[model samples]
Target chain A: MSHTRYRVMEAGEARRFPPEAMARIEKILTRYPTKQAALLPVLWVAQETWGWISKEAGEEVARVLDLPPSHVDGVLTFYTMYNLRPVGKHLLQVCTSISCHLNGAESLLERCGKRLGIGLEETTADGKFTLVEVECIAGCDRAPSMMVNDQYFEPMDAGKLDALLDRLSREA
Target chain B: MEKVLTARIGKKDSRSIDTYLADGGYTGVKRVLTSGMTPEQVIEEVKKANVRGRGGAGFSAGVKWGFLPKDTKGKPIYLFCNADESEPGTFKDRLLMENDPHQLIEGMILASYAIRCRNAYIYIRGEFYDGARILERAIGEAYAKGYLGEKILGSRFSLDITVHRGAGAYICGEETGLIESIEGKRGQPRIKPPFPAVSGAFAAPTIVNNVETLCCVKHVIDRGAEWFLKIGRNEKNAGPKLFCISGHVNRPGVYEAAMGLPLKDLIFGAEYAQGMKGGKKIKAVIPGGASAPMLTAAEIDDCPLDFDGVAAKGSMLGSAAIVVINEDACIVDVAKNLSKFFSHESCGQCTPCREGTPWLYKVLTRIEAGQGRMEDIDLLARICNQMANGMTICVFADAAIAPPLSSVTKFRAEYEHHVTQKRCLVGARAAELVTV
Candidate 1:
């Protein structure tokens, strides 16, 4: 609302550390001996503020942590957890690793794709969901594991998936 | 033999400090700090307990802690809990931390004390957002209760614990790669010679330990080393071990038992996996995470699920993440899937690993699609052999070869069938081999 107090209105371009986020960054800095070491956590805070790390978001992170943009890009691309582009409201990651593959992962992913009317790494037109295949989320104990944003849904099948997707769609 | 690491798992309010303390959680760390047991004594007990790492490598935890320099010349020692549990079939650490966060906290405190670490961090993978929140809450509780921070329990021992989440690089599980990630750099591993123990995390002497291994330190202190030696199949591989049984198991989950539980027993035992799904016939097993070579059904018959036991049969007990394959699965399909995983996860640090992983996956894909030549089978082994054993800065190249090489060796006939017959051999889509 007040453009005078903020550098820019965007999450990444204007790398605005909300007072709470700034406090978190300060506390994280105390955890490490150097400020640069707080880059990962600070970047995480940025990602949490924004849905994904855009080019401007990456540059803002570099500027905040005193790291070069190239370094931020390199670090951002290396880790799969950090999203490079905007994601839909819900991001579903299905595991197709050895354990999950043995279980019906391929078919499970196909079900999600067909039901959502989107292929792998695609977001629905309504901007409600994005489906992608991830390596492993350490839920091998319950094979055919899928992650809905941050929550783990295990032993996923077509029936459970349909019900779950119906519920997500029904939500405002 | 009783549950050590998983004792608090499945209990009511398990993640809370109140429940943890009521169940005697931090008593191990309290006993070590208050009982006048020197840091050296704690390290000695861990060494005697013979606790091997649970994160794939199975190296001795005590021996790893002992590698810290006797004199750091004023640099504060650091302790990193490797929570990057990305190994394909491993998920025990996630269960441990999610259910019993204090168990890991207590274990890290004891381990930090043993190594004179002033600052400790849990480098958890970012995918484990649930676990990170649980641990952050647990650590706050510990600090409020004086189990962590300055003058812990008024015993003159001071330490701080932080949870650093990895963005999502599998290589970060490698100790050096983890160190680099923590330093706000790419997850590419640092060259060895001056290992993490000598200089790591802010260029200070650091000790990186697996989550389960740190959790084991609490028990080694609680019950004493001799008591630990009595539980397992043998003294060399002792203490409670968590084996992650995935795939076609009827009751697939994390089963903790005395070390050296026979491989077949874990698969067919009443208490473990309770046999394969639909009583399907076993074909092959990945004895340890994706890194360890798979074992044929015959080779796994008398196999023991310990470091030395699994090794005796040709595969290392790398994380004890047992993934079973029944008669319905295709071996070529399995190898190709694993190769694709390796190709996707390669850190691109080494020439051979960066180039060779996708090459291996491409060849496997060709074979699985009924497009492989007979010579491609031998070529697979040749490509695998060149990528590992000092071919890279880290052992990642070595691990990327496990699936391809082992399958080619044990399931040669299956590979031959795929090439000669131009299709899979076992799955529903498989065509019968024609001898013309």
Candidate 2:
């Protein structure tokens, strides 16, 4: 395969991973009934340490989990949470379920799209916010809801959303 | 008027099938069959009631029923009841099946009649062993009573309601995936376009609804649509809903409440959630079900409990399984636990979900293990960004990714400290933290 195309975690950064984390990764390797079972959690740790799962980091998780790197890569790509690239600080998750749709969630999404200056799957240029249209957040009674940085903000309107952005911006 | 949704499970006396029949169980079937009520009238009544599907997605039940092709060339039509109550913090379906099996049977009969189907299947999860048995017994009872089987209620309608058990896969809760599993296939999702309405079980027209959704049909007809519409607080979305409350709440069971009720009232009010356990204040809440985004303390205040209200806040009013998070619970631990579930449950069908869930889990485990870095938090966010959008067949992939992404984003400093200081902020499972 071509090593030039894949992003590799730097050695300096790898060295900064807490020794205990490395030890725990080793422990996770032993604790699992099978090495493959440990693959997901190991990649999770790598993604945690690196901010995203790079191809190199994925290979390392694969090694620790005692599986092929390709297997790890496949698992990483299947879930929506495992980011392969960089993203902004605030992750905006909008629910686009049936109830949300009826409750004008689409309009809220449009407003968010316009304000964030990015499409549904696109991240902002400044890497401050990445707008995402997610599946049901399961608060149908509170339709037109959103999760900013994992905290639920209900009954959002244009005004409240703008304020939320302002607050998140300050925090970021 | 004891709200039927959360009534005692198999009270066996007053609420048993015999009691239910005495109180007019299978009467709807009789009424529909004898009263000459066409399927269109039943569907129209359901539409007027504005009844929504109770299984996570609040799609109108009547609208869904209307979608089935009016006429088919004698191809078997199927009515599927989603008894797969696998979503974490969701238990109402199990309770309903265990308690009032007759209500469900009647609902299935009515639903089957409206959809012009001969066979109906109640796909219960393997874990709900007792519930499945109860349903089988109920089906047997309905058969003896002549409500089900060839020539139901002595009318031309003959329906067979089968109780099929799932081998424990959450993806089977999805309609198409459920259909796939019903056919004895490996429970993975099929692409849309040939939706269940067009090509469902055995490639015949099918209608899949939650157990609660099917049950609501009985009420929508018995009480008339106006009475049903009057129950919910939201005019647009009507009908009573069951709130399954767990985690840190004083009353951690299912409660029936009008739609559009505020979350604060549900959580803090004396009779509702009644605050957290041990008299502790609620610090956070996963307002919908497990998959809904986590809610902070301030945001929990006065948030409405309906689909529209939840959507307004960028969340969803999913199955309405309210999971309360107390002050002491570490957000990282929450993320780690949720990550473990999605990772284990991933069908390994889609590339992103199959791989991303475990990767997200690893990062969360590392952080919880006191090995997180500043970049690790961002990396968590990055993976969540990638995994949370259109990456898989169902929302399970998104469900797995959102928690860690949200946790790291919300509590970055805590994660940063764990990495820098080499310790979990919370003492729970500290040894496991170091065990990789």
Candidate 3:
């Protein structure tokens, strides 16, 4: 497996929340009594706005929440969801935990790798899909599950997974 | 016993405010607010019902609420509903949040009133994007209906609930770790003595409860405590419980059964998992989530599926997640998979857990790959002993050790065969089929 570290967005890169994101951020801020308590929600807003959370995005969140840049970086690196580098249009997070593994998640992942001609954590040549093996997404009842973007697809075998990939490719 | 907790799940428009209100929802909170009952009375009622936390700990919910200092003159009390359901085999919380959002909301309001808190937050796991959106919409509907916000239900009580999403960390399921994550830090469990009730969430008196536990609070109020106590086997393990059955089962899904149901029934009963898939003989069972020790097929025959029952059998009813393993799968492989999970998810705040978990994974991987020495077996046990109990700040380290140690003890011959033969015997057949 490739061990690529999270890339840092260079200085002078333009990164600011648009008007709609600002409105959402304001609404989220009202939920918490303190500005710092909204840090995770605000970081989510940043990630939603910029696909992945870059260094510049982290700094912007820090500025908005009045937190230190190092603190933002620490929190960002701790969680697995915040992507620090740009990803494909569709992020396929396959659950490789025990239950999924028992139900053929490894073979399903291998099939994805074979079909896409890319290994786990690699993006497709066309930038349509990025496959990453993740921990349990809590869909054990329907094992060998994966999440494309934010939606869940489960009980997937090689044929069904291939069909899903073909459909996504055509849609994209 | 009736399905009090998950009764509304799978119903049409179950998440909407109108559907919730039409079904006599919000009555629990309304009764609490409108009646002349004090916070202590609410706590006493809950205590009488014996509602235990659905989260792994299974502590008494009412007793935990009573931990708050009576006089927090200037300090604000906070109530956090832990929606961070990331335990490997646990998925019951997501169903309640996604389907019966108002049930949880009503529970939260009653819990807040019992603790006399004005602010509450639901720290949901990051993977549950759909559940979070549904809960957000439900909260909005609640606010619009005046079930929440200022002077709720024309009573002096008021509460504002917020939905905070965690960014993929299993440690956040721990109450203290959850508090730290909501505070915008690494999700690490804090050392106790200041306990959350003493000082939590912005250093205020806080009471953190699981999503299902809070939902049970709604029922404990709607139906009297005596009624709730009469549903399950006994007062100690009262009320309907949600059991998440997965792995090797014919119908692997969430089943709501009375507490203290037999483990064999949950696995083989038609209403539960409908027996193992393909008529395969059961080899072992992980009674709880990956954290609890595995029970050999023989040991699980008549075991009770409750906190005390499972504990009596040398395991926990943690999250009530039962993962059945058939004879086809390798025990060594199961141990290795769980080791990898714990090692990856460890917050690395403690020395034994950070160093011990990865070491356990490395040794297990080596053993699974046919490179293990005989001494590695005793070494593995030694490491587990060191990491278990109160050796660390939290139980994460202890949980990490359960799979490997338990598997080796219960299935020592399997580990020995892998080492001596330099190949996985049980997995060899599957590998051969794959090659063909």
Each candidate's interface RMSD, rounded to one decimal? 7.0, 13.4, 2.6
**Scoring model 1 with DockQ, what do you get?**
0.47
lDDT of 2 by residue, B170-257 (tens): 7878888887766644567888867898788778898899998888898777778888888766667677778877666666566777
The docking category that best describes candidate 2 is: incorrect
Model 3 misplaced stretches (Cα beyond 4 Å): A1-5, A8-12, B427-436
**Which residue segments of model 1 deviate by more than 4 Å?**
A1-15, B427-436
For A1-172, candidate 1 gives per-residue lDDT tens digits of 0111112224543555578877878788899987777889988988898878777878877877788888887777777777776778999999999889988899999999999999877789999999988888898878789999999998888899999999999888
By TM-score, the best candidate is 3
Q: What's the TM-score of each model vs. the native?
A: 0.95, 0.70, 0.97
lDDT score at residue B291, model 2, on the 0-100 scale: 80
Candidate 1 lDDT score at position A34: 78
Give the least accurate 10-residue stretch of model 3 chain B, judged by summed lDDT: B427-436
Residue B189 Cα positional deviation in candidate 1, in Å, after optimal superposition: 1.0
Docking quality (DockQ) for each candidate: 0.47, 0.02, 0.63
Candidate 3 local distance difference test against the native: 0.89
Predicted model 2 interface RMSD: 13.4
Q: Which window of ten consecutive residues has the lowest lDDT sum in model 3 chain A?
A: A1-10
Which scores better on lDDT, 1 or 2?
1
Steric clash pairs (candidate 1): B56-B318, B56-B319
| Candidate 3 displacement at residue A82 in angstroms | 0.2
